[model samples]
Target: MTKSAIRIALCVALVAAAAIVPAQAASGGAVAARSRSVILKHIAFHPRTAHIRVGGTVTWRWRDGSIVHNVVGSGFRSPTKAMGTYTLRFRARGTYNYVCTIHPGMTGKVIVG
Candidate 1:
């Protein structure tokens, strides 16, 4: 095959590989998650409580457009954003509570064990 054909094949192969791979959190954290995502929509956390093992990660994806939100927990906090992502890696075993300061009664927790 021509060099051009080989280059095209390589590009296609790369794209396919990327598609099959699980995406890491924005933090670029090394730990993978047992439970991958939490959706923020309609002013609430979809699961409300997330469970993961120690060294696992939890990613909060903001889907509520134009309405800003943030995750403020014991030792970590995310920037107040309307359209972005927040990732937390649980290093210890226990329950970590979080809330969106802008919205009262909007709360959740991460249970790591």
Candidate 2:
């Protein structure tokens, strides 16, 4: 095939593939509505960045390995604990940033879509 024809075929294939991908809706969309877990240990949150669909939940489990820590973020905060679990539900489509109030440089984010 000629180069120009090959390029046209590739572009058509790319557009076709893109059209097959699912699309996310806005406002009261059908999110996967699942849960994710993160391990809080070693002075950090394991898997610092989590991705979930809108209306999903994230659970932060405290592994008994250090001082007190908590998950603090916009309109959400878990109690400081040495050993326990905290869960937050993401109801909106946005990014939620959190950190441990007692520990510096301890930060994480949850991306909701």
Candidate 3:
């Protein structure tokens, strides 16, 4: 075969490989995992309760009209902060509880499966 013909064949093979590659396979490992957010308003977590899968993350945002609130974990003293946000990743299959230190009556829970 001619040298130019060999080069052209190689180029065509590369083009075919590129065209057959799945887009997802190229960046699948670097893609960011999906996450969810919950709002804290009216001195309480808007949903008050929720369920999520392991490896998922939940972010708590202070709503504009919300009263001061916090997300306190067990054995952890002093709630995080009011008008502030906190994120927790559910890495295990279990239930976790949190409450507002500013207001003892406000509470929330997360069930991970």
Query: How high is each candidate's TM-score?
Result: 0.69, 0.71, 0.60
Each model's Cα RMSD: 9.6, 11.1, 6.0
The C-alpha stretches of model 2 lying farther than 4 A from their native spots are 1-31
Rank list by TM-score: 2, 1, 3
Ranking by lDDT: 2, 1, 3
Clashing pairs in 1: none
The sequence of per-residue lDDT tens digits that candidate 3 reaches over residues 2-73 is 999999999999998887676656665423444677788777786777677777787889884646666787
**How displaced is residue 71 in candidate 3, in Å?**
0.3
- Per-candidate clashes, comma-separated: 0, 0, 0
- Lowest lDDT block of 10, candidate 1: 24-33
Top TM-score hit: 2
Model 2 agreement with the true structure over 66-93: per-residue lDDT tens digits: 5789999989899998998998888898
Top lDDT model: 2
What lDDT, from 0 to 1, does candidate 1 have? 0.86
The CA lDDT of each predicted structure is 0.86, 0.87, 0.73
Among residues 3 or more apart in sequence or in different chains, the pairs in candidate 3 whose N, CA or C atoms overlap within 3 Å are none
